[model samples]
Target chain A: MLKLDKVNSFYGRSHALHDLSLSIPKGQITAIVGRNGTGKTTLLKTIMGLTVKSTGAIDLDGTDLSAQPTFRRARAGIAYVPQGRQIIPDFTVRENILMGGFASTSGRQVPALVGALFPYLTENMERPGGLLSGGQQQQLAIARALAANPQILLLDEPTEGIQPNIVEDIQNIIIRLNRDEGLSIVLVEQNVAFARRAGHHFAMLEKGRAVAAGPIDSLTDELIHQHIAV
Target chain B: MLDTIFIGLSVGSVLLLVALGLAITYGAMGVINMAHGEMVMLGAYTTVLASIHLGIGLLGAIPIAFMVTALVGYAIERLIVSRLYGRLLDTLLATWGVAILLQQAVRLSLGLAFFGITIAGLGTGLQNVRVPAYLSGVISIGGEQVSLYRAFIILVTILLTLLTWFIMYRTAIGAQVRAIMRNPDMAAACGIDVKRVNALTFAYGSGLAGVAGVMMSGFKTVFPDMGTPMVVDGFLVVVTGGVGSLMGTVLSAGLLGQINGLTASVSNDIIARAVIFAVVVTIIIWKPSGLFSYKGR
Candidate 1:
């Protein structure tokens, strides 16, 4: 389980995430839903220790990760697939995927899971990542994260900007990873219907604070209208 | 003409060594390390001291100089450069201060001047390293006579540059370095220790500069201020070639060195310097990013 308790994150003086607390249970999908600029991304960055400064405790499993650096936090089994699918443009697809293996306890290698799920990436392993389409780039990003052999996956809008046909494919893969691989996932998504479909638990954020959180069933349309609808 | 061209090649080789480290550090870390030239000064000094104290020859002093400068570079990264990662101007200013400190440290013989004590091979005085008997004389190549030491400098630079290429492209550490050079935050997110890689990169670059110093000490009189002009020359190569492109550095160094050599051969060293500066300014105005800048996606 990954837990954040009263975390306040800052970016060189501008407060990004206020006193926020959230828990992501093991072997479950927790969707973080909120309006634009509501700190959904900051929460994920805070967990990854990417923020300039953050106060409060971040516990991953039994390991206290608040004081740990980003690389250490990743080594401890939290893999982040950030927004924009920030793959190295010049790096080959194989190299891009193997990059996540730096955090893997097993060392650097393309995991069998990546080859199984991302066949296109496996086929184009020699091609530069920048040559891929947006959907393909998203797949490469996920494949890269999976190579880490992470216990928890933090995805920030994985389906955003992807083609409509590939969107469902990506969403289904996210569900399968949670159900079949039994991996804990913290999903920051804007598609409310898809969030309700995939998330076992939900957290509604507002101005960097979690105003509503509970089982996915408790995420009422009223709550969505009140906090997320713009 | 042939002798002048050979001289240009040798000069270009030394410039390549000096610019290589500056290219990597400035390209990867965005640090304008004004103290980079100090590493060269330290390397030349290391050769002088090694000869005087340990009775070590020029060849023997090479590795020692590398190690000494690398350690100093690591310390600079850990203490000062590391703190000023994103602040480019601050890093330039801080490293310039470090450059002065290093120059003064060498000039004063590590503060021994205050106590009226002077080390034999140190302090504010010019020094020279004797070339080995084998490298002291010229050899016939084709129909031209080439200085054996100059040939040795060219050969060593070629070998070191190849070694650098292998390390950057064929090694795991190299991949991490390239990754950091492209996107530091993403590299960290992928679990690459950006700080560790950066420190190592800085040390390696300093080591190369030290080797350049040793090469310079063989041919020129070494003094406290010898490396100051070298820093400017090295940056000229880096900027004209392109910040991060190794091939660019190599080619531009050769081009500029040839320009300097050919012009100096025709006119004077002062005129050659002016011509080189004019060419660099033209290149900058023409292609501001560099000759072979990496294309962003």
Candidate 2:
């Protein structure tokens, strides 16, 4: 389980995430939904400890991670696939994927899971990541995260800006990882329909605070209109 | 004419050594390390001290100087530069302060000067290292005589540069560094310890500068302020080559060193310096990002 208790995040002097508390159950997909600039990205970054400063508790499993550095937090089994799929452009597809192995206990290697899921990336192992199409890069990003052998996967808008044809493919991959691999996932998604289909739980964020949250069944259309409809 | 070119190659070799560390530190960390030159100065001092106390030769002093200066660089990163990562101007000012402090510490004999005590190989006076007898001799290449020491300098630079290239391209540590260089936050998110890699990178760069210092001590007088102009020259190479580019640093150092050598061969050192400055300024104006700047998507 991943839990944030009264967490406040800041970027230099500007407060980005207000006093926010959330509980993400293990081995399930928890969709974080909100409108643009409603701190969806900030919530993911806060969980990753990428913010300049943050207050309060961030617990992963039984370990306290609020005071840990980003790499340490990663080593502790939290893998973040950030917004924009920030893969190293100059690095080869293989190198980009293996980079996440730095946090893994088994060391740097292409996991069998990646080979099965991202055969295109495996085939173009020597190609530079920047040359890949947007959908391909997003696949490379997910493959990179899986290289960590992480217990919890934090995916920030994984399908954003992806080609329409590849979007469904990426969506299925996310669901498969959670269902088949039994990995706990925190998915920040803009497509409410996709979230409703895939997520077991939901958290509605507005102005950096969780305004409404519960099981996916309780995520009423009224709550969506109130906090996320914009 | 051939001798002048040889001289240029040797001069460029030393400049490459000095600029290599600056390029890495500045490129990876976005830090302008004013104390970088002081590492060179300390390296020369290490040679002096090693010769006087340990009876070590120039070759023997190389590793010692690297270790000594690398440790100092690591300490600086842990204590000061680490704190000033994103603050460009503050890092410049703070490292400049560190440069002065290092120079003063050397001049004062590590605070032994106040008691009117002077170490034999240290203080404000200029010091020199004797070139080995074999190195002092001239070698005939294609019926033209060339200083063996200058040739040795070129050889050492080539070896170290190749070694640096191998480490960066073939090693896991190098991958981490390159990742950080391209995108630090992303690198960290990928589970690379950015701070640890940065500290190691800083140490390695300082070690290169220290080696440069040891080389310089053979041909030039070692003084507290000898490294000051070197810092300027190193920056010139980095700027002309493009920040964070190893190939750029190598090529630019060679270009600037050759320019200085060829001009000084005909005119004076002062004119050669002026010409170098003019060339650098022209290049900057022509291509502000530099000759080999990386283009991102």
Candidate 3:
């Protein structure tokens, strides 16, 4: 569904991503698991057009997305949930959810559809985003991406700040979205066990390049302990 | 004595309008926007020029002035302000340069002579009060007499304040604006077009400033360096009121206006300015972040 060929992204003189290539199959949760500062976020930024300088090809459904801005990339059916689940705190739950509709391809309201993805959001639609606790904000953040109805959802640490119970809720939502909705997902995470649950495929990034890539089954517990357990 | 409060409110209302837009551009956008005061100058000068040169009525001149100044703001942002945006000191200096250019441009074209705008049938005095004399005329609250215009200005300020509050807090665009302000990266990730919203916010903020300029020029004399005088206070109001908070901006402007009006009656106007500037400095040195935050930005 998505392909990156010989992609290199830079932040000033510091090279954040090397000549890395990644591809995702349809209807599966693809996990790019790495320690912090391992170019995982940079990869997502490059795909989302948030990177300042990038040299490579990013194609989604055969349409080149390397030159588009972040918003443009989103309109092209790529939804991203950034690190820390950055919600617009001053905005009400409904407003934050409505913000997701900005990438609505049809230019029509989809409240019922969004409510289906995260019912709690629909329930507390009038409350300010800041008023929600950490876990609830994470749900709202994910629901916001779902509201966009993208072909692929790129989530960066959706479970980082939430409690264990809410983490399970997020995991279940991810499962439902992928299994039932057939939405492609590129999840960047630091937790191995968390990544192992929904991740059907895994790639380990070190320094700035992908050092390992294969199906989730190939990433044995020993390999996970050796590289990602830290 | 009651008339003094009225004077303060009229002055405060103009300050509120001027400061309200500054709250959005500098406060919400983090653009520094030193050119904001200059935009107000552009509007006032545009209004005067429209009335004098084109003989346009005030009604026609209002929207025309708004648009032209908005375009001026848009062009400045696109050509100059946008480039200097990421760098704080650079944006400050660049916008100041734009302000100087605008001021000098007006001086070069129109010269130093002041121009008068005669409102069709409206005179300088408040011949008609919206409320009855007992209600509209200020009673002594604090050893000061407020006049009808000043009282009316306070009421108008409240109304516009509420309107802006509703637009910013309850509406969709308001959410977008606050979203962009809080977390541009998150907002971008969520599919909100940061640049487009930013441009609109800049234009809208400066446009409101333009309206303030139009209203101010009607009350005061229109001169080339008119905006320069208040540019510092504009900064101070935002700082003291807490950066980007609409309520903060209004409160600060009102406090500053009353202090300035009351002080100028007794001491030099500079004393009034010094008092307000002192408060702003103290606030920043103490709590750099303003009272209200568009958090997560």
Candidate 4:
């Protein structure tokens, strides 16, 4: 389990996440839902230790990660698929995937699971990542995260800008990653229907604070209207 | 004419050495290292000290100078640059301050005067490195007389350049550096230790500058002020070449070196410098990004 207790994250002088606490249980999907500019991305970045400054406790399993750097945090088994799928454009698909392998305890190698899940990436291993379509790029991002051999995956809006058909595909992949593979996931999602379908738990955020959180069954439509609606 | 071109190639080789360090440091870290020239100065001083104390010649000083400057670079990164990451202007000012401190430190003999310890080769004076007997000779190829030392310099540069290329393109560490160069955040997220790699990269670049100093000590007067101008020249080459491109640095160093050589051959040294400055200005106005700029981060 990954836990954040009373975490306050900052970007330079601007406070992005304020006194936020969260817990990601093992082998389950927890959807973080909120409107635009509501600290959803900030929460993910805070978890990854990418913010300018942060105060409070971040624990992965039994180990305290607040003092650790980003790479160490990654090596401790948290893999991030950031917004915009920030893969290296010039690097080949193989290279992009291997980048995540640097964080893996097993060392740098394309996991067998990547080949099984992303046959298109496997087939065109030498092609530059920028050449891939949006759907393909999303797949590549997931494949890259998988290469880290991470126990916990933090996916920030994984289906934000993809085509409708590819969105369903990615959604299924996320569900499979959690349910079938038994990997824990923290998903920052905009689509409420998809979140309700896939997530076992939910956190509703507002203005850098978690306004509501609990099991998916308790994620009422009224809570969504109060916090997530524009 | 052929001799003049050879001279140009030699001059370009020196520029390449100086610029290579700037290119990597500036490219990878977005830092404008003003003390890089001091690294060259330290390298020359290492040559002087090694010859006097260790009885080692210029060839032997190459590795020693590299190590000395590399260690200094590592210290600078750990103590200063590491803390100032993402603040470009602040780094520029901080490193410039470091350059002045280094210059004064050497002038004061590292403050050894308080202890009354005096070193012969380390005072504030102009020094020259001695060339071995064989290297001082000239070789005739195709009835053209070529200075063997110049040829050796060119040969060394070519070999080093090739080695740098191989490391950057073929090695795993090199891949990490390139990945960092493109996108530092993504690189870090991928589990690469950006700070560790950056420190090593800084040391390697500074080490290259030290090698350049050793080469310069053979032909130019070695003094505290010698490195001041070298930093400007190195930055010029880096800017004219693309900021982070190894290939760009190599090609631009060659181009600018040739311009200086060919112009100096035809006219005077001052005029040659002026012409080179004009050419650089023209190039910058034409392509602000550089000749072989990489489009993305």
Candidate 5:
């Protein structure tokens, strides 16, 4: 559903992503794993147009989106939930969720669909985002991305800093979205256990490049200990 | 006293208009818009040229004032402020320069003359007092005398404030705007055009200042230095209210207004500002973030 060809992104003189070419097929979860500073977040940011790519072509389906602004890509069915739940602190819980479905506002049935995911949003529509716990925020963030009804959802560390109990909930949510709705996702996670639950497909990034990638069953304990398990 | 309350209310309304926009631009966008004061000045000048020179109706001129000043704000954001945003201190210095240039231009064009505004909206209820030709005269409220024009101003302000709230909370555009203010990236990821929303926000903030300028022109003398005083108070109000809280701005406006009005009677009019500032300092010591700081720093 999404393709990045020889895409190179930069932050000033430092090259964050080097000739990174990756494609995410539709109807399944695609996990991108990496150690710190390996450009995992940078890759998602590049796809979202959050960080300007120095060189490459990004195409969603067929239309080129490398030059398009972040908003344009989102409107084109590419929703990104960046690292750290970027929930508006002051906005109400419902308001935060409503913001996720901004692209859906133009459609006829999106509001109803979004409301169906978290009835609590419809329940406590006035509660601010700051009042929610980390787990709730994670749920709100993913629910928001789902609201857009996007072809691709870029989730950068959804389980980071979340409690273990909530981790299971988030894991179930991700699995359900992938299994039932055929939601395509690019989940960046540090916890292999949680990432394992979220999806079976994995791509390991190291030092600004996609070093190793394949079906989850092909990975061994040695690779996990060396690259991912700190 | 009732008199103090009346004065405070009017003063609060003025502060509300001035700082209300800043709550979003600076408080939310994190852009220290030192040029905010100049936007107010520009708004005042719009009224000066439109009402006194073009002979437009006060009610009609209000929207025109918003449009013209909003255009200036849009231009400033697109051509200038947008580039400087995020560099808080640099944007501040750059905008101050823009402000100085605007003041000098206004000073050159309008000359150093203090002229009175002709009042047209005052009904027969306001025509009974002994007042200056330009002055709208005093109205009896709580057995105390206050300028009828100022009272009328209070009503308009209340109406405008209500409208502002409705737009911020109830409207779809407002939801998008608050989203931008809350988290620009998430807002963008949600398919909101942050730049466009930002321009509209700037225009809205500056436009409110323009409305206040029309009132100031009608009530008091328009001097180059007027923007400085209003700006100082505006910064204080938005600061006291909290970074991104509309309710905080409203509450601080009343608190600061009463402090200025009551203190002015005991001390010199100039000293009132010093007293207000002292009070503000004291408040900040107790609540550094603000009266309504939304969440984590």
Candidate 6:
């Protein structure tokens, strides 16, 4: 399990996240839903140690990760797919996927899971990542994350700008990852209905603070209207 | 004309060695390493020391000089450059300070006077390296006269450039370095150790500069201020060729060297220098992103 206790995150003293605490359970999907600029992204970056500064405890499994650098955090089995899918444009698709293998303790190689899930990436192994469509890029990002062989996946709006048809395909992939692969996932999502459908637990954030958090059944429409609805 | 072209090629080769280090460090880390030329100065001094003390020839000083400069580069990166990663101006200033310290250290024989022990052939003076008997004279090449040492310089540069290309394009460390060059944060996120790679790269670049120094020692006067002008010439090549583009650096060095050589033969050194500067300014104004800027996703 990954846990954040009273974490306060800052971006050069702007104070993006204030006294936030969360427990993301193992082998389940936890959706973080909130309005725009509500620190959903900040939470993810804080976990990755990408923020300007942060205070408090970030424990992955039994170890404290607060002092660890980003690369070490990756080796600790937390793979992040950032908002913009920051894959190297000049790197080939195969190279992009293999990049994540750097974090794996076992050594570097594209996992068999990547080839099984996205045959398109394997087929266009020599093609530059920039040539791929948005939907394809999303697939590449997930494939890249999977190469790390991580226990938990942190996805920040994986389908935000993807096409409608590809969105359903991505949604199914997330479910399969959580259920079949038994991987824990923290998904920061905008689509409330999809969040309710896929997530077992939910956290509602407001102005950088969690306003409501519990099982998906406890996420009432009233709570959504109070915190998320703009 | 052939001799002039050969001279230009040899001159361009030395410039290529100097600029390659600056290109990689500046392009990858966004650092303006003003002390880069000091690595060259150190390399030339290494040759002088090795020849006088160890009784070795210029060829033997090559690897020794490379190792010495690379270690110094590593220390500089770890001590100063590493902390100032994103601060371009601060790095420029700090490295410039380092350049002065290095120059003065060599000039003063490392201030070893405090220990009351003096070493031979070391303190405060101009030094010259003797070319071996084989590389001392002009050689006949297809009815044209060519300086053997100049030819040696060109060959050494070509071999080193090819080695650099192989390292960057064919090795795993090269991939990691390139990945960091493009996106340091993302590279770190992917679990590549950006800091380690950067330090190694800085050392390698310094090593190349040291080799350039050795080359210069053979043909030019070696002194405390010798590296100051080399830094200027190196940056000129980097800017005109485009920052971070290896091919751009190679081609531009050749172009500028030819321009300098041809102009100097017809006119004067001052006029040739003025012409080279004018051409660089024109290139900068014309293509600000450089001749071959990398396109990102």
DockQ scores of the candidates = 0.83, 0.85, 0.56, 0.70, 0.69, 0.77
TM-score of every candidate relative to the true structure = 0.98, 0.99, 0.87, 0.98, 0.89, 0.97
Model 6, A67: alpha-carbon shift in Å? 0.5
Shift in Å, residue B260, candidate 5: 1.4
Interface RMSD of every predicted model, in angstroms: 0.6, 0.7, 2.3, 1.5, 1.6, 0.9
* Best-to-worst ranking by DockQ: 2, 1, 6, 4, 5, 3
- Name the lDDT value of residue A150 in candidate 6: 93
Docking model 2 quality class = high
Docking outcome class, model 6:
medium
A-chain TM-score of every model = 0.99, 0.98, 0.95, 0.99, 0.92, 0.98
Expressed as tens digits, the lDDT of each residue in A98-167 for candidate 6 is 8888889888888888777788989999999999999999999999899899999999999999989999
For model 5, residues B1-297, the per-residue Cα lDDT tens digits are 666667778888888888888887885578877777777666666665665557764555678878887887788888888887678888888878877877776665533333433333221111111123444677787678877777766887888889999998898888888888777777888889888888888888888887876666665566555677787888899989888888999899889988888888777679988898898999899999898887762
Relative to the unseen true structure, what is the C-alpha lDDT of residue A97 in candidate 5, on a scale of 0 to 100?
69
Flag the better candidate by lDDT, 2 or 6.
Answer: 2
Q: Provide chain B TM-scores across all predictions.
A: 0.98, 0.99, 0.80, 0.98, 0.87, 0.97
Cα lDDT tens digits for candidate 6, B1-297: 788988888888989999999999998899999999999999999999999999989999999999999999999999999999889999999999999999888867798855765556566778999989988799989999989999999999999999998998788888888888888887787888888999999999999999999999999988887999888999999988888788888888899889988998899989999999999889889998777667665
> How does model 5 fare in lDDT?
0.77
lDDT of each: 0.93, 0.93, 0.76, 0.92, 0.77, 0.91
